[model samples]
Target: MISRMFSRFNISIGSVTHQIFKKPTSLSRSVIARKFCNEIARPENFATAGTMNDVHIKMMERIGLEPGYSPIPRSREHLIQYQPSSADLPPRSMADSFTSAVIPLSSSKSLQDLYVSYLGHVRFGRLMQDMDLFAVWVCHQHVNIPNLDKNIHLPYTFVTIMVDKIDFTDFSPKGTSDIRLSGHVSWVGKSSMEIVVWLEQEFEGTYKKITRALFLMAARNATNTGPAPVNQISPGNEHEQNILIGGEERKKRRIDHQKMSLLKVVPSNYEQSIMHDIFTRITRKDTIQLDKRVLPANGKWMADCSIMNTIPCFPEHRNAHNKVFGGFIMKIALENSWVCAYLHAKSRPKLETISDISFEKPVDVSSFLQMNAYVTYTEMNFMVVMVVADVLNPTGGRMTSNVLYYVWKCNESVPEVIPGSYHEMMWYLMGRRKLNYALGLTSGV
Candidate 1:
């Protein structure tokens, strides 16, 4: 059976072109020509053999992890570091056109005018498995900052999700919305620089803020030799002092325009840079692996928060301060929970349990959020959507919310990654992938 499954993946040199939305027709199969046996397919039982496992684990980490780091968020204020390398960067591609989408027509919409007014940064979540693999694998390429002439775009496979900023808070699929997405590179680089991008939405009569990301690039060598040394800034540090001094930022200011300009503004030392450090060039990438995502709703309600019923983020949904009230988010979340379970039954299922929910944090009125649910663990006759609601920052950065909802998947099987032959494929299947990587496995599943 396993052999049969693997055979489906084979591709011959001379085969027919693939079709649209259908698996390919021709696949080359090989015969091991051995006898059949009943045993586990996994080569190593990761449980025992602590010593050997540790050795292999280190080796895997060395090769498995990408080089460079998550790019640093530009400081509202400060001088950053720099890295240098090839100047040419990958270009960004945009949609030739977008389809018209209709949002709810409301009379009393709070912040309605501002909901999706101005646009900036965007990161399309995973669209499919292979694309997701490529997305994760390519995080290390760097590009210059100032020369980052256009938007910073990267592609990943996903189903339905749009995270953006709505006035004061971030906006997501709050109410009914039709969001179309495609993929391409906004910026490409070898080192010391990268282009960045952002996005927003068009709704009713306004456009909203999507997300903004920057890529300060640095060039890497088989060995290390460049305009400046690499910066190793610690990521996610609110403190300014911990930032790296050399990488993309340094490369940005190093451009003299002339080989030996009359004036050289960049200091000779790497530590002199106050804005960036090694950590800064490292882009903070959120990997959403479909399978590794465990919300723990066994036989519980499940809603693919990315693209389900639009949970409104309006005035009636807010409090006295004009901010969207936490209570309203909770109420709507729970109600949506029931709706998800009902959908799972192909109509409606018995609402056996909510199991649990937590408002991890206040989901502001204008905040853009993407809520995804899953049945992380299960027991016979019971399952749930371990719900997760995440907030997106104006710069297209995301933060976890104070809320969590366990939607029930009343009638569903233990989910698994759509299987593939690559080690990366198995890794994702085994839940070894990242959180954002699972955007494709929605409640619709």
Candidate 2:
């Protein structure tokens, strides 16, 4: 069964057009095949080897993960002696950490084919994955500041904890346009830095903005798994100052939201908030239609949704810290959510925005990961899917690892998701807030 699933991948892997990175033209098909075979040939037990399977490899390829890939080494051996000291912070310029990468969104045939299954548009999930990956690299560069204690640079690992203020002004660059993804360290804290990333498409002569996002990453010490100090970013100009200010404001908002989320009860002011009003109005008896049959409901709640998909996490999909990459998790979550959206809407789902995604805990490698996606709410020409990923433990317990909120525009013929119970109603209201927040973000609220 596994071989059958990998049959297509085997063919694609051997093709010369499958080049993910620059390789020697003289590299033979046999060499490529051998490399792939070696990747999958490991200890029989996944718990022991954490080898990636066919599903993991295919998904990684769709999101630009090259097999047998190794990044350029940055650290030089014996460059400086390691020492421990608590001293003044090393200040760094934003330019020192700025990084930009350009890719032809349409010129790459492999990429185009990978996006073919995405309703004729470049997969939003893949684009998001690249954004996260690039942002992580930018943060990594910022944290690699020279150590005051030693001549060597501080070896720090970073992980993306939050993503926000995402505004995709235009559709993804699909055809022949080249997209330049740029990231810079905009603001810095004791152990965290705000990396702002922008995606632009090169039009006839000028570069047009496609999407912009903010990623919050925290630095972890190499020796101890604790917060590590990051270099302070000094703005060079007025524009840089403005960007830094924006990052600071967003950081405050993130802290505020985190605190609010932990509150056992909603604050008194929340009762007067727009979301509270929306929830109250939608849940009223007079506003709801009782006799009208919402198409596709069939009077059975279970028949109206999708089944759960469970997969195992593997080492090949992990980041530098051995934790699963956020991009990989996002891809699986989006795909599963898209399935639920398509089944309910009976139409192609075009992604609008990944409103919010919270990583509650790191998904342990070799753990059974289960994803559940359901259409929480549907309005005119739009649908919201809430996809949750949980890690199932050996003791038959489960812990929530991720919660993703997605928004998509659907076909007109698709019916709205009618809430059948109080629990579903709460989800419906939450969906409304998610959509509203996405719109506000686009409008620069």
Candidate 3:
């Protein structure tokens, strides 16, 4: 059935043109933390202008950082890049240039300068991107049928946008950033929609526009769109296509990523899946590596690998100080790995300890971070996930590396492991474990 969210909203596509975005210092962790400390050291009871000051309060107490944390700010910067209605959009399919360049983004630019300039513009971009995406969803949800109520309802983030791909102009400032995003969506299934996102960069303004990408997203028919069946996008096809799928697709039972619903508030797993989709869709990655784990009946499991992008990083991924926010990356890498582990563990096992995890170098928020994870040991109902981070640079050559380690316990709580699945699961886990160990990857927390 057409979603209610789609049914209630108005359906006219609109645009805010010739807009600019400014970086927000308050959006950064360092700045937020500093402000958080100054405001309320203990981070006790507080109010954030009201809705959920408590969540932020708890966050500060637990992580000693501001509870106002949101990756939305980074996403906000992304909105401005859209071709405004009054502005010109590239005519060619936007799939040509594909490469990542590493450049210095934190050139001692003060947070005040970055914030004043970036955030101010960002607000405009945010308003524009959101309005456009909303407009598209508003229009599409109507099915454009007559006799329909102009009042339509769409689940939050229910619209899907795809236009002919256009040639991308090198937008990253020299010595500032090395990444730009490529977006592509095709009309797939009747109700299901598919999108392709890639991250690319240019250093000398000389490299080929792009030839590779690895990112993609799937949206179905709901308040939130589900996987669509478009000929142009194939989440399963890695080598030929240039994008990553945000949600994981499993055979027998649906993996958490694929099992999304907006009936009651979106499920947590679904939310994560959607978030991944936004990032992948925004970046337009060519290939994506996912971290996964599984538990078996006889003794086996498998974990999807991490996503590695040759594309340079954008300022959005960095911090006010320009350093790749270790915590943010760590959380993303870890959470994704955990989800992969969950996929591998069909038996629904419990969490175990995180093996040795370490960060090699300080990744610049502006440089791309190549990350991956894997699992091995089916019989033991155990899996180890690893992550590798490579920093991209436009001039000095790629130079930084980081890694993560995740350990999952197959049968910690249950006495005999699940009813009839332990034995077979053991076999699978053991085989995967061997493969993971052979890779000789570094570990991380």
What lDDT does the true structure give each of the candidates?
Answer: 0.29, 0.61, 0.32
Weakest lDDT window of 10 consecutive positions for candidate 2: 43-52
Consecutive 10-residue window with the lowest summed lDDT within model 3: 244-253
Which runs of model 3 end up more than 4 angstroms from their true locations?
1-317, 347-349, 376-379, 393-400, 411-445
Task: Show how many residue pairs clash in every candidate, following the order shown.
Answer: 115, 0, 124
Candidate 3, RMSD to the unseen true structure: 24.7
Winner by TM-score between candidate 2 and candidate 1 = 2
Q: How far is candidate 1 from the true structure (C-alpha RMSD, Å)?
A: 26.4
Q: The CA-based lDDT of model 3 is what?
A: 0.32
**What stretches of model 2 exceed 4 Å from their correct place?**
1-88, 104-120, 147-154, 175-177, 202-206, 267-303, 411-414, 441-445
Q: Which digits, one per residue and each the tens of the lDDT, describe model 3 over residues 281-399?
A: 23323445432222332332222222343545555444323455444555555555666565666554333433323445666655666555544332235555555566756666666
Q: Supply the TM-score for candidate 1.
A: 0.25
